[model samples]
Target: MSEATTHQIPGLKQKKVFKIIVLGDSGVGKTCLTYRFCEGQFLDKSEATIGVDFRERNIKIGHEDIKLQLWDTAGQERFRKSMVQHYYRNVHAVVIVYDVTKPETFHSIASWMQEVESHGLMRAPRVLVGNKCDCGTPESRLATTYAQRLADKYGMPLFETSALLDSECDNVESIFMTLAHKLYSKQPLRVVSVEGELGPGVVTLGRQKRSASSNDSCLCS
Candidate 1:
């Protein structure tokens, strides 16, 4: 990482901005994962995302202030095209999530990665996340060994986490914080970019909701 001079968004003081797109099959808890990270609480219920939902949070990593913009994409096939065309631009990282209890959803990880690579984003910092660990029975859950093998196939790290547990918030925090630090460490500072309204085919059900603040220690190495 270069200690080079950084630029800023017009009204913001963040030293860097990282765009992370969250992808997974429907009902895999993609929205809840982001809600937990941004709000520090589990979201009890949420509507299925139509095309995409945008959420953001500001955090201080060491002495540097950074903003993380998360794009939660809809999992349904019909909506995937517009999302791929519009939201995949300028993404710094990718989080491909799956439900621990549903093996079909887990199986869909290959397709999600194919979508990412289809957009020529094969080299972006990507991680595999198995969500909803708290709601599954041992007999019903997919083995972590399998998830690890798949992650290994892609040469990315795998993290198994639960969005519904307050006790597991640190695990949730570590997922994104790890990505932020990785992106910040390896990339050069670029001007903060903003997203315009999704025009034409895309459905934008949720506006961007900003997190309150970030006054905490780095949870990942």
Candidate 2:
């Protein structure tokens, strides 16, 4: 067997790591989502992420230890140019998040999607996340139809979650875990064939298919 394939064998391995990038507009809770998944704690408020912040989490999947190197980028408009110029080149997966309560945040999805495409990372695995679902306010509750439309347009998996309640938070990890497994196994990343053109689609990087539905309630305002 090839060296790469041999590493995937159970109980016969060396250290392996995967790099993941979290991209979204400022105040869209990108950091919160990372923290919630990595540390299992949520801060009510946080300063905007500077140039980038790094977090590492080890998750075991089917007898393999996958070390996730998560890169969180600053989402302010000022940082956009720099990210486009230098940040996304080495990323394995991209998580695009937006605040469900703020339609404007939702509207900006197209712009972020554009950025991802500009970098030619469209083939990368992407997970569309709608945050702040626990608020239960009219604004925070995103219509399933709207999310599905976006998902179909991008050929990506759409997941709605609330970091405050930890709902479907594990699902976020699962998405990345599946991606890592495929990458380690040397399989091609899966791509969904979007039906219509709503906007530019993201690059998908895994072969496994998952439902475009929210698994639990973990919304926060």
Candidate 3:
């Protein structure tokens, strides 16, 4: 891990921080995916996150220094209701994960998305992930087409990845880095805009413009 430099270069922009929450059912590998990206190592075993856990990583992209605060939330029904508000509060992005081998987990994505919508995080950059791909066989895994269809329905990109595999672990990093870049580029700070001559100004933020390849950009390649 590289230490953040204390010395500041003249004219250089200060580091930007973003908060990202990972949501999924227990055993869907949310914690493992986060550990791989932030720690660069696969977690062979982990207990269910109690309510929430946080991890931070410093990265640079195109001359921009970024700090990612990844919040790994507990996926159990018991823990969810108590912490849902806190999890969605001030979140810059959302990552919805599902186990490729288990179709039920994939089905639960809709409910999870509904949770995001209920908390008014619909405008936050969100992505869908099918995890543990390496553990599934052709007979057991859900088709990529179905996953893509869900992603298309939600207007978000879909990535199929295995955090436990050395070869595919880089995809895990790509997933978060892609979101970091998107949030950094959007600069979602509060801004006041005048709508009419005799009306009060409106404050707007969190709106995003979709790119040509945004819906299909899978960094797994």
Candidate 4:
């Protein structure tokens, strides 16, 4: 079956909001992944993403519902000002992607890590993604190794994906869902209760006993 036919599966629904940011160097295919996952569509011929592009898709994990707000940012160095402006806030998870065919792109992981930290979003769950994995050759294995090291450094998950071939696509949504579940579970719970008055409320009863004891001591003096 053709790629077009596969994406036409019916009745896909949108659930909860999960804000995910895609970060990588220029020409690494961040926009393509966002379009493929959210719109289920692909364009072989396209321009680089400008400042930002938005896409949304509903994903389900067991009994939980998730809506992914995928953000595709421009990866060019000249666009740093615009990129930093949108960095950090409201981001639940991040997917730091790099091109497997371009080793330099893989090396830029350190810079990307710095960007994440500078935005004060280092605590957010992150996934290191090696895009164009179908192009992986003996030469490209080196890039993969570097990608793994970055994943280890950040204690983040790693995925080698091909937006064109749909490789690793199934696992992508689950990664976001897992992050969402972890974030939700870490939230503190608050409880409130009401009680009926006793012979006296605890505060009033304690105060009366203290006053009586003081009065007896004063009489003795």
lDDT of each: 0.82, 0.71, 0.81, 0.69
Error of 3 at 121 (Å): 1.2
The prediction achieving the highest TM-score against the true structure is: 1
lDDT per residue for candidate 4 within 1-221, as digits (tens), equals 12322242234233436677889999988987777777665547868887888888776645656677888888988877655565456686788888889988888988998988877668777888787777767674556566677789889887877777754566554555566665444321100000113233433534575687898888666
lDDT string for model 2 (1-221, tens) is: 13324434344336666777888888888888888878877767767898888888997756867788888888888877855456575676778898888778888889989988987768777888888877667755778689879978998888877777756667666656666765565422221222112223222211121222222332541
Candidate 2 residue spans exceeding 4 A from truth:
1-4, 7-13, 136-140, 181-221
Q: Using TM-score as the measure, what is the rank order of every candidate, best first?
A: 1, 3, 2, 4
The candidate with the higher lDDT, 1 or 3, is 1
Error of 2 at 137 (Å): 1.8
Tens digits of per-residue lDDT for model 1, 172-214: 9999998998887666423211222323211121122111122
Model 3 Cα shift for residue 94 (angstroms): 0.2
Clash pairs detected, candidate 1 = none
Instruction: Tell me the spans in candidate 4 whose CA falls farther than 4 Å from its real position.
Output: 1-15, 82-84, 141-143, 171-221
TM-score to native of every candidate shown? 0.80, 0.74, 0.80, 0.70
Query: Candidate order by lDDT, highest to lowest?
Result: 1, 3, 2, 4
Candidate 3: regions farther than 4 A off? 1-13, 188-221
TM-score of structure candidate 2: 0.74
Name the candidate that leads on lDDT: 1
Worst 10 residues of 2 by lDDT: 203-212
